[model samples]
Target: MEQRKEITMSRLQRFLVVSLIAVFVATLAPAALAESYKFGASKPGGSWYPIGTVLQRLADKNYGDKVTVEIGGGTGNLLNVMSGKLSFGLASATSIQEALKGAKMFKGKVAQAKKVRVAAVLYPNYLFWLVWAKSDVTSYQQLKGKKVNVMPKRFSFQALNQQMLGALGIEYKDFSKVNYLGFNDAVAQMKDNHIDAYLGPGEENYAPIVQLATHAPIRILSFSKEDVAKMKAANPGVVPFTLDKTNYKQKNDVNTVQTFLLIITNEDVPAERVYKLTKTIYDNLGDFAGAVKAFERVKVANATGDMGAPRHAGMDQYLKEKGLLK
Candidate 1:
């Protein structure tokens, strides 16, 4: 009886030891093998945020344990990626062009901005000028001497505001009061009637504009044909875009200047990784569009348009495969 009892006790002890070893291996193994990819986007509730989320989900689902993504600010993201602080990010064509040409925001910093290429032309962003419907401001030219909320310094929106205003022969001092507020702050100020005008680029279905329209009558001011031509002539990155009537609550079509938002990465990133990321985004376009209505127009074939820089080799490869590129 004693010998039988000893045999059972020894077998139970060995089983517990084996179970502990297996658990430890299972817990630590993935950490050692997993790879991560970072993508920078704008703040939450912004268009870039949802796009980043879609990319993250696709990477997670397709790459499994191999890759991940981190989303952050727009222009700030470009700086980070260029400095090797991030793997990839989203940027506007205008800003990217400035960076490449060492113009405006990129003056004396161009050396830090080379070899960046497009991953995709994500979507079109309209330069919006939201104003109270009661206001007499029907066009960009009429906003002269009126209070305006231009974006703050270091923000890409701010740079764009300055460039567009310059193209129209307007200056900061020309406005009665120019406040340097951010997107949320600008929306709040507009709601409170603290400012007469706020100019910036955003997705077509921006929530703040819709919410404001519900309470107060608002108008999306349009650019004149001459002004649009001047803007396009001055800044090749600026493109003429028209917002359909339904996009705004006013039920009328509005013409405006726009900049294309694009996914960008340093050319130094490995081709395989870029290929994987591009492939994942294309494979899951439906999922992205369903998640965010703003992404409804995104297509793999349209990934190369309105780009200010060359296409990344990896993305180029995928586009060639899809017959999107020659």
Candidate 2:
């Protein structure tokens, strides 16, 4: 009878050990699942889209499902984070600054701009005022009394168009007609001759613009040396940038205004996550350059050069560790 009791006691102990092991496994599973992070990017077919894809691939490869990325409109990137729709996004320094300062674009009296900070300065996005080569408009000043397609509502391009026009002492109402359209729609309108000009920021060799230039001769309105200075003074964030002839089908240099395309994140995101994302980007810098030619212009030495706002603490820490920041 004692032998029988011993066997029963041993079986009960084994069952208890198995139950505890199962409970521990169950407790740890959710933590593993919770590590995945979501990142927001701008529209597809642009520079930001590919960069986000590269980042997502790198994250999946390195972290094994620890992070994911989503793409949306660039204009809404900052507000999306503020509203908690996204964890992070790509944004223009100028727009982000205005949002932070609660300027014209933002609705509230003061925006929690301090909450949004930079991860890295990607590349210079040049403002291309594309006009038909045969169009009578030769200069920005000449665009007056001509129909212009700035950009659709709620987009960064619209804000840029307003600021630039304001500096030039021209307003949308001053133009004969102003059509607000998305990038694709604007391109279509230009092709249809419904608009005389399209003013917005883009890479020097942007595919759609290049295609347009091929079918119909297009002239990139050059900002005169004096106008360039005026723009810089009006908007300190405006950087002097030259689009080399090689960047376009037409072999002629085009000088214009430019701004930094930045990787932005909110302070609420964990510093560790930001650090990891930034590190991944820097380490795979070559791959990114291959993915997007514009990335070739991005250098660690100049990463924060044109930034209008403060860098994120996590980015600062990472850059400091690499001695990129002093």
Candidate 3:
């Protein structure tokens, strides 16, 4: 009996040791193997945030909790990705071009811009220059002496605003007052009659503009063909777009310029990793479109459109594997 008891104790000790080892390995395995990534999304009250959230859900779910979404803007995302602070983020075609050339918005960041790469082309963003219907400001030229909300500094919208204004021979100093605010804040200021005009980019029926229209009648200022031509000449990524009455309570379709939205990533991201992400998104396009209506326009064929940035190798590999690229 004494021998048997000693043998049982020894077995129990061995079992406990093995159990502890198993627990220890289990606790560290996920952290050791998971590929963590920081995804930069747009700020609050913008469509990019929600779109990024959807991407986060898909990436984390499929990649095993590897991605974390954070607030970012178009120009900021490009700069951050180039700086390696973000793994990937949203940008616009025009912004990418501007950054690459160190012109307009980017000014002096040419070398750093090379560090950023295009992951995918998502959709088009329409420029909206809004005013109260009661206001006598009828055209973009009239915005010269009016207070305007150009969105926060470093926002792609602000850069685009300046570019469009510059094309028409207008300057920030020309405005009576310039307020750098975000979507919600800008809309609030406009509704309160604190600002004479507000400008930004968004898909049709953008939420902030829609909300503002509900509170008070608003008009979408249209760009003349000549003005658009000048902008396109300066920014090749700029394209003519129209917002029909269905988009807002307007008398006719509002003519504006648009820029293609892109997913920009750091050049250091592994090609295999980018391939995985690209494949995952393409396979789940329906899910993305369902979550974000703007994504309904996304297509695998359009993913490789020129956005003035070098395409990542992983994205190329995925395209090749799918016969989308040779």
Candidate 4:
């Protein structure tokens, strides 16, 4: 009888150990099967790249393990994702719209347009101009006929700048001189007081803008309700916005216009994998905010903001799971 009781106890212990092993494997099985990916982003020092680095860092610690990030052009990033050549990319909603129609920057209708999918809306790209605080440029309208650097021709910011001017019924040709200069030259010209204003968009605490503020008190031009409406009217994806007065060296909140910046991927990735990536990002935004200032504005409400391209089935599923898709 004693021998039989011992045998029974031994069998029970073996069974319990096997069950725990099976449960552990079940929990981690998906991660083991998870696919690695490359993230295409803008050049280093640009606002977009920092977000990508944070993304990969979190993904590597989660399921999108060892994800590779690349610095590349906007059009190529989105196109590569759709073609399955890249795992993911960052792009603006407007650019994705153009690609869908094979218009503007794209030669024709993109062959892989259908595969393009949205992961999340990172933040809105705000467009405005800035000058030293002592300068008398009072409003966005006042900049008309002033010597301004609207960024150079290579960045494709020229057309966007033209749209901002058109909203105010001003033409690019109307400026005293529309200098197609780079950021460094713009800052140099600003310090020398050679230029009256520098008009462009970037993160509120954009390094160059912040650097300029260090040498001279700077003021970013603010848009009125009516002008913001007109600008958004002319541009479909843009939304009216205001900067926090307390942050980024801003003395008062300034009104502006914003276009959605999207994290995009393709249909080739499995639904479950994309779901994990989307879920992780939204859940861990606090961790990423440390990497860039723009992150402070990444609200959950904007997670489902329209991005022209359809949402990946995986991302959509995650949203639905969290009750964010309603």
Candidate 5:
């Protein structure tokens, strides 16, 4: 009877311990699951898609259970971040600068961009226009009467468009038909011969255009020194660049303007979470250098560049701790 009693007590104690652990895990599930975030990569046609993918994988690999990235892009990411619908997303430094001023790109949505903050600098991009070989279009002047997809709708992209076109002494009305569409749609339509030309501004060897070239056999329109000068006159941030044919599938080099890209968040995110994320990025910056063509230049040292938006307090704290902040 004594042996049986001892055995029964041991079994009871084991059952009680397991029950307590089950309850503890159940209680923590909400907070654990709540850590996941929706990030915007824009459409599949751009660097945001692929670069964002690599960034997501790197973050998840380091802090997978604490983070999740979603597909999104353009002003959608900015507006969503403003609305607290996203944890963060990618956007251009120029547009974010304009948005912070409550004019230019963001216009009436100053409140939205006001909530926005920079988490990291992804890379820089350059603007280049392309036409199909069959179009017989040789210059920006020839695009005056043709249907054109300007790539940037109105918000984040409009500034670049205005700057580039203004330099050329042209406007949206100069085109017979103008559409504000994503890079993916523009590439698809161009491939089908639905559009005459595409005005694309992006990182060197942007995937959508690079992919489009493989099957479409396209050509980038060359800019004259006077046109480039006028473009530079429009935006000082806009610098002259040359895209090598060997890199982007063109027969020759193409001249364009350059700008920086960034990953952005809003003030709504908790400081701890943002700090943790910023930590993950800088700790693994070297691993991301060659994730994609444009990201090759990524450096933890550039984490504090003039991204035109305020840095999230969490991000700033991490940078300060690392002495990465000046």
Candidate 6:
């Protein structure tokens, strides 16, 4: 009996040692599997920033600190994704098409376009032509000979502004002074009357416009049929949209043009990781929609919509499991 008891104690000690080793390896497994991915988003104070932040938070929750979000412009996002500088980025569908076509700001980078792929289609971004309500500059044509902020150079909004303005026979030279600024700086300049107009594109109730309006009433320039036709002629991606007074109270609905926003990924990202990333976002979409009003439109049905870029295989697999794709 004494010998049997001693043998049992020895077995117990071995069992405990093996269990501890198993636990230690389990703890380190996640860290071993974690691969860092860089995510690019729009500048601070813009809608894309918050959207990207929410995604980053979700990724951190699901995969630890394997994903990092960085500030990037629309055009820059596409370029960086192509160059493998970013694993993924938020970009407009129009800009993706422009990159693929080597058009507009993407003139001369067509070869790199093949590296970009669509991860998800997020929402629509409306082109906002904002001027102080009391200012005399109410029309796009009236922006001529006036100091204006056209966003930063090579920005997707700047490209859109140039395209639309080009259709109307307007150019940066036509403005008394053209300032290339980001969202916050443009809003600040507009508030101080340093700029007569600010041409940029963003989701409805974009934060910068909301902040600018609190200082002084601002008006969103409407697009006429002729204007829409001209813009569409310049870029087929331009679509007519009616901006209602949900966010900004206007007496009447404002007519404008809009483009879809998408999440783009580099072709080299692993299919399994992309699948997990898509699952993370799709599973916690409520958190995203809660953070950004624009994200409310993100749905499984629309997540895989054509955004002028090839769909990532990982995203496709997730959509297929949801019965969205064959």
| Every model's TM-score | 0.83, 0.83, 0.87, 0.75, 0.77, 0.89
Which candidate leads the pack in lDDT? Answer: 3
Pitting candidate 2 against candidate 6, the one with the higher lDDT is 6
Top TM-score prediction, candidate number: 6
- How close is each model in CA RMSD to the real structure? 6.2, 4.5, 5.0, 4.8, 5.2, 2.8
Candidate number with the higher lDDT (2 or 3): 3
What is the C-alpha lDDT profile of model 1 across 1-326, one tens digit per residue? 99999999999999999999999998887565445878887666556677777777677666653333454556787787777777778777888877877886567777777777787776677788878988998888889989998766655677788888898899998999999876678788888888998787656777656666776888898777998998888678888888887765665788888887777888888876777777877777787787766667776667867477888899989989988889
Alpha-carbon shift of residue 167 in model 3 (angstroms): 0.7
- Pitting candidate 2 against candidate 6, the one with the higher TM-score is 6
Q: What TM-score does candidate 2 get on C-alpha atoms?
A: 0.83
- Shift of residue 173 alpha carbon in model 4, Å: 5.5
TM-score of 6: 0.89
CA lDDT scores, all candidates in order: 0.77, 0.77, 0.83, 0.75, 0.73, 0.82
Off by over 4 Å in 5: 1-34, 52-61, 64-71, 133-135, 152-155, 224-226, 249-252, 285-291
The order by descending lDDT is 3, 6, 1, 2, 4, 5
Q: How many clashes in each candidate? A: 1, 0, 1, 1, 4, 0
| lDDT (Cα, 0-100) at 60 in candidate 3 | 70
Count of clashes in candidate 3: 1
Model 2 per-residue lDDT tens digits across residues 109-225:
244676777877787788888798788877898999999998765666678778888887898888999997766777888898898998887786676687687778888888778
Off by over 4 Å in 4: 1-32, 73-76, 110-114, 134-159, 166-197, 224-226, 244-253
lDDT of 6 by residue, 212-261 (tens): 87888878888889888888888777789988866566656788898888
Question: For residues 226-291, what per-residue lDDT tens digits would candidate 3 score against the true structure?
Answer: 878998987898899888877668878888899988888878988867776777778887887776
Candidate 6 off by > 4 Å: 1-26, 245-247
Q: Model 5: what TM-score? A: 0.77
Candidate with the larger lDDT of 3 and 5: 3
State the lDDT of candidate 5 residue by residue for 174-269, as single tens digits. 888887778778878888878888886755667777767787678788887888888767655566788787765667788777777777888988
